[model samples]
Target: MLTLPQLRALYPEAPAAHLTAFAAEAARLLPAHGLAANRQRCHFFLAQLGHESGGLQLRTENLAYSAARLMQVWPSRFPTPEAARRLAFSPEALAEAVYGGRMGNDRPGDGYRYRGRGYIQITGRETYRALGRLCGLPLEEEPGLADDPAHAVTIACAYWSWKRLNPLCDAGDYAGLTRRINGGLTGLQDRYGWLERAQRCIPWPEAGSEALPLPRLRAVQRALKARGFYDGSIDGIIGRRSLAAIATLRAELGLPGEGLDAPLLAALAA
Candidate 1:
């Protein structure tokens, strides 16, 4: 299972407490959605969710845009600068203007009401209805549930399962998975970065072959334990104990007391 410390280490900008809660909930909910069996799916899921949600901080879409920016983002709706200026900073009106008469939004305020929410941004009344039917929830009528963290993970997993994304994840088809989830290859670089960090963070026992081998961590653990400078289990997890032992060993060797790297591993071995 993905630990909170690993998540914090991967995304240092995120709030640790919030990530802890989210990880707990995801652990509880994602298994039923078929994400627990394969760590690749879990890694892809975390990368997509973390990137889309801005490290699990942003829930609602930031529709507040300057006229120029709005024109750039929604060129169809704001073809002219004057049109963009008319809807500038008015999120509700802009949403209605951009999304109305599309995505099964027929009524007056359906667009704004059913706008993107959840970690994966479950957008549109049609999507809400389809996901709602699949999950046995009335998300079309009560779309606000998608914004709440309590329901966000479940909704994301449901959407993933609905799109059959696990197979793409297993095949390492990140581009295809992104297209399926995001409708395009938007944020491709960032998605890959998050995937790389996630692969590093998840433990090997849980991550299987998808885990990037960190031979240094295990080697350091063994070296420190053999030298009587470490007392913790040789788990390769760099917790406080491992860090303390590394610091002590480095100080004793007149080496830099910061950061664990190849040099530090070599020193520990020596």
Candidate 2:
């Protein structure tokens, strides 16, 4: 089970109520879903959850995009800057335009009605119906229920089980797992960073028995080195040199506190 401190470390910016709710629900539901079967499983599951929920700060999808962002995100749909501008900052319009005719959302208001919600962002009417049946919740009738942290955790766990993602986690197939969850490899590095941070924060019994994967550290090292804050080899080992580099980078970026967090990861990635 994850302690409050552990949850806080994983999501430093999460609200107190959300943190408390997630901690309780994760502790209660993770084991039931076999997500806590091992350190690796727990790390991967929490990492994906953290990434999907934006460090536990978001339950519903934010469809308010700038025109440029909309064009970049859905090039085929928007195609032109003017086309995207028409829908920009209009969440309902954007949702209806982009999601209306797909994902079993054929009815007129079904897109906005069944927009992405929950930790894993369960979108569309069919998904809501399926997860609703599995969780014994009227998610289709009451989509807002998925916004609750407890229900979000339940929906995420059910989605995980329905997707049969444990074998992929067991095989250390992070890319495949991302593809399954995200429908692609978007934010793959961010997911890895979340996993690395979770591996460090969570009190896994087998933690120092072997060298853990360090893709996040490697990416950080590369970023720091590129910015001339670090000169060490990009071997993914966080030694004194890496720590110093991270501290310097954080200070330079006006970010408070110490060590790697979500903000630091985003800055590095950006």
Candidate 3:
């Protein structure tokens, strides 16, 4: 329902010229795996990218694209946090202070070299390590990539893909996406008073069409297979038998039988 005009209205400053170029590039890079970005989602991504890079002024924007290039020159190669911090951290002592202690929990501390991170800044060293693994980037190896917008955006894209953040389904409307992707509704209530008043990004699909689709369906099949519920195809289709298998898992897991859709998927993930 979000239109091109609506997209421009959200971030009027995004260069029309650059977006045209980016659209071409994105079309090339995406949809290879049915990962196409519709008009609104494209704007959603661009808005995030625009916000992160000071409206695209920072060279660090979309760091993953150039991380390998930067690493070729920077080459993290650390003997210790102390050695890495000397170059990457603001103060070696402070840097050591955060990550120096055995890491636990997710809250950001100034001690870690990559103090704040993620698409919208989920801070702390533990997050960096976890995100690195999820995205297949050696976050500890190149601590600087966190600050680079290019790497940051690529990491964002990778993170989105890693978790399959489809607004059309699974993400529990917008608040859930905010909680999961933006790290637990920290800024939503404060920023827009939208906590009590949730914003609608994508209308949750109706039943039938709302059935779990590929990759997600595949995950459900895999989980059921692991639990020894369904012995059917691992193909990404949720047929009637898949539902029965999931119903069995639901009864065992003590969850309400919500059949084969978002609620079930959410419970499965939980």
Winning model by lDDT: 2
Choose the strongest candidate by TM-score.
2
For candidate 1, the 10 contiguous residues with the lowest summed lDDT are 207-216
* lDDT per residue (tens digit) for residues 1-270 in model 3: 333343344435545643343344444444442334343334334434444443434423222223234333234434444444444424444344434554442333434555445434534566667778875778766756765534554565665665556662332233344445554433332323211111233232332332222356678888788778889988644556776897787787777645565566676672
Residue-level lDDT of model 1, residues 1-270, one tens digit each, is 657777787667765555766678766777887787887778889888878888777777868889999966667768999988998998899889888889899999887888888778888899999999887888987898887656677788889988899887765556668888877666766777787777767655642446223354567788899988899986445556876887888888888646465576567653
> All models: lDDT?
0.76, 0.82, 0.48
lDDT at residue 152 of model 3 (Cα atoms): 53
Q: 1-270 in candidate 2: lDDT tens per residue? A: 888899899889887877888778877789999988887788888888888889878878889899999987788888998899999999998999988988889899889999988778788999999999999999989989888866777898999998899887765567678888877777776787888888888978753221235665688889999999999998665667988998899989999966666688789892
RMSD over all Cα atoms, model 3: 14.0
State the lDDT at 20 in candidate 2: 88
Stretches of candidate 3 exceeding 4 Å from the true structure: 1-25, 28-110, 133-136, 167-172, 189-270
